[model samples]
Target chain A: MSTILLIEQILNGLQFGVMLFLMAAGLTLIFGVMGLINLAHGSLYMIGAFAAAAVAGWSGNFLLALIASLIAAAIFGVIVEMTVIRRLYKRDHLDQVLATFALILIFSEATRWTFGSFPLFLDIPAVLKGTVILPGGIEYSLYRLTIILIGLAVALGLYLLISKTRVGMRIRAGENDREMIGALGVDISVLYTMVFALGAALAGLSGALVGAIQSVEVGMGEPVLILAFVVIVIGGIGSIRGALAGAILVGLTDTLGRTLLPVLFSSFMDGSAATTVGSALASMLIYILMAGVLIFKPTGLFGSA
Target chain B: MISKNAKRTVKALGAATALALSLGQVAVADGHAGKLKVGMLTTLTGGGAGLGVDIRDGFLLAIEQSGNAGIEVVVEDDQRKPDIAVQVADKMIQSEKVDILTGIVFSNLALAVAPSATAQGKFYISPNAGPAQLAGRGCHENYFNVAWQNDGPHEAAGATANKMGIKKAFIWAPNYPAGQDALTGFKRTFEGEVAQEVFTKLGQTDYAAEIAQMRASDADGIFFFAPGGMGISFLKQYADSGVDLPLVGPAFSFDQTILPAVGAAAEGVLNTAQWAPDLDNDASRAFVESFKEAYGRIPSIYAQQGFDTGLLIASAATKADVKDADAFRAALREADFTSTRGDFKFGNNQHPIQDFWVRKVIQLDDGTFINTAVEVALEDRQDVYATECALDW
Candidate 1:
């Protein structure tokens, strides 16, 4: 209705898109290099949330919790990669899916066993608890603004790590020709482990950051996992840039659609009818966007053909 | 064999009547020879397990408090599926021969099992999942609910919201029967403009988009009807969205099961329900304390309802003079028990005619969250279809 409200909605969409990007980056990387459809990726996200909650509870500090969550998730990822994931790497996609599905059960049950089926609370630090006034007289949560900034930083950092580093070179090589990379005596097994750990760490970081805004619980990683899958599929599988682009795209579409669709519908219909139609359409907006993108550019906006 | 069966039935009925009068903890156990077979079905492993576990914990604690009776509760995981619940119900009835069927966390499961219990002539006292359809047109004689009907609490919230002069409100719920019942129940009481009536995905985690939409809407309050993990996730996101709108919901959102998960985000949220841990009564206090002592957590409404289910069935068995399912069903319809919800009696529809209270989450002296401090008592809360419930008696 108002310019200010529209601007606020757009900002909200951008923040949501960035959060999706954080989740999509790791999943795309794992899928690109490992050629394994890891269904248990959400479990790693849960691991990060639990780790953050535990560390934050212990130290009474948020920064320590964030660092600890990433490290803890990375360690757990490497351990899982070595033990269960490695066994399925050479196996078929069906086997990998089943194995990872089992991991989800194991992870969820284990977390429930430890946490006793209660959700843990992660607080936003006092510094980021208030609202900030934005341009156009719009108000926004400081914590969400921080997420957008942190998400951008993560994107930049990931870009540098993948494009500039020696490990990045090997990862790119591995993605192109895994057999040749292993044949060149680069300890491909260790490389795979590290890559998995890196993805896990990123997922963990996202979980920790997002946990402050959502309830940290046993299966919290799952919905995010689905969104990340959409992101990668939209951006182009195994493409970081594609993931980033696609995540933002999906996020903005989802947020904006939900906010504006009802208003759009209300123009012709009554309020109640508009709301019912609007909300239903809003829920389907992202998948519709994905379908449209697929129709035109099948590999995704940034995915390699 | 007919004479012997008749005598056993008379004896069970006599015990049930005496037990209600006697106020004995272990009221009726003579009917089930030695092995007290109890089948407990709840959502145990998946998303809805949060509520299921609470119900399970309550049932187990009641058994423990009753000195871990001669009864063996064979727990089955329903996973919140109606079809799975039916299978579990069949197994409990046919194979396990569970003298009592209790502990259902969702209404769909309750509906599936309630009809079957009536057909099979077993006493099915539901701890939770008071479905609307059953409370009205399809009301069963054998099926009894320890919990209030699904509409009861939400109706209280809606009434309270209207009284507070909250003119413009937003209603959000999952797309299901219970969700429909919740919003409908709320709208029945709250005569206000509903800015948006949205149905979210069943297991939706992110509320950013919805929250943003609400921010732009003209609504003064947001009413939500998400339970278990869904409630926890939605509440946390709603809090973080920086909308200063007052939040109100049913007791399901801020119960002992989900309070810990949402933590401080749940603080100051108002809810309407039949049971709170801090209800001003000796029975409620004792139940809460004993439950906490056993489970290392506060007892939720789920637990209270589950415990009530056990008590209801046992009391029924004592009254009916028969340990068999038919006698117990008859006795349960009599509905003679003083429950944790305080002086609740069964209506003709076999649903609870109980008081719904407005409850708020306040920090206890131990720095833990609780739905304490009852504000108002909405008595005899029933469904919109209560008029449709036709009973002979």
Candidate 2:
């Protein structure tokens, strides 16, 4: 394989990884603060994409779509939190899982009913419509590059929000001692709702950004949700830094393995056999990495030990 | 206490929505003289719902246009799950006692349901899926496919590629029976060296790695068969990546329902299909006009197949005694219906021997994408698997 091709593949991996981070960040935050497993987190992602597509179609403005996605997801998140999730907080994990799973079905059906079965179109903005020549003379999509930058900025912003702000302090306090924080002057219920909405807005932003490059349709969030779960699990369930690390790790492994495995196998075997084996192994590469990581560090790369 | 009351209200609302959604599926009976019961099972609420919705809509439109008071349709959502499809099929056969079974869109779901349905002496007139196995040794006398065989469009693509003189081509498909069949079909007719054959995970959204590999390959042309959202994602990403190669594929990817979502990414892409909205035939024109009037959008190939299924059934019902299985089956074999596609006939295997056209995606004046037939690629093509069938006439 050419060095340039390898470099391009890595960039693709990085782009994929960063997007996963956007999803993982929210999931990890919700879990960290609320001590609740939100299985319907992916539904929020779908809501965001639909909101973006709807806004983009009406106004033909990418900026408006982005804002709409965030606002819609946040409002929806808060409503879900208030109506259903708050009730599940004192319940057991099994109940939480079942309730959220029901939410998935409801959200999926409702989205289909509202938008119709066909995918909605969400276009790349005019300014970021083409490719750019990187340093190695490799042409890359400017839109994909923007996604990477946006993900990084969001990650940094999340870090600042958690470590440098009063809301962040309260979130940390809640994570460590929910009862104690509630005993203190902080309105823990409102704090929980805000935290959930913030996480949802992040998910919505990711959905809108990715929706431009992919189809905006129902059940788009399920695949990403599974990956985000893997990211958070690998990163150390509650750590933003861990989510980033785990996401990049999973992304690079998946991308590079998929690209290089067939070529490597073909050198030692026949073409068709090599391809069959290589692709099979490549699909499992990330899960294999996760298994390996768990064997070595049960808490994940950055999870609390 | 107030918050608890609010929670109860919310719970009630959720329950009401669920109840209403389920209630929507309950079939309404319209009293008619002749009895022809059809159980329409198709994906209605998942990723593959677009194609299924088209099929259901077209099938219903045909039934409506016929004003066949004898026909009672029982529509159910399969949710694209094979197990669920089997359960629904069983209910239709045993409980509903529908005379005709149709409106299955996926080959996997069809494979799971068709065999059992046909074995029970129920006629399965497929609206969309035409698995090769069913055309070969698995073929039954009672089973009929209104659509082209699964491999038909892909073989047309291969012929088109050969005509275009593509020396080296890279092919990609999702890893499944249909996907494998697509590649095999393409290779059967194409006289060119395959640079690469990539089988991706079904429903894989991201294709960056695969695209990178394709870009680095020395292939002059590319062909892929990714339906629904997968196709939408792949086309968009491939366009964004700026890999300027001649792209060709089966019409599933560039169909009318998905073409708008694919947008300019699908422009100039060649696809092969047995039906296009622009086909110059009376039946085609009427079906298109009526379908548009009913559905407010251009019909896809799946919809065409559904309409054809309805036509086939309606024609057979009119001519033969549908109450007699033998007469109905024989009449269906005569292929007396006026197909939306001009000059349609059935092969010995009961699949359509239809003309496959080379279609190019073009944007209309109203800024919507539709496929226009550029040329006829294959004429009256029968699937290769037809010779394998041992069915006695």
Stretches of model 1 off by over 4 angstroms after superposition: A264-274, B1-36, B66-70, B81-101, B108-124, B321-326
Per-residue CA lDDT of candidate 2, range B284-347, in tens?
Answer: 9999999988889999998998899988888888877767999999899988978999998888
Predicted candidate 2 versus true structure: per-residue lDDT over A87-176, tens digit per residue? 987775556766887788888879977998899999899989879999979988899999999999998998899999999999999988
Candidate 2 Cα lDDT to native? 0.86
What residue runs in model 2 are displaced by over 4 Å at the alpha carbon? B1-34, B321-323
Residue A205, candidate 1: C-alpha displacement in angstroms = 1.0
Clashing pairs in 2: A236-A303
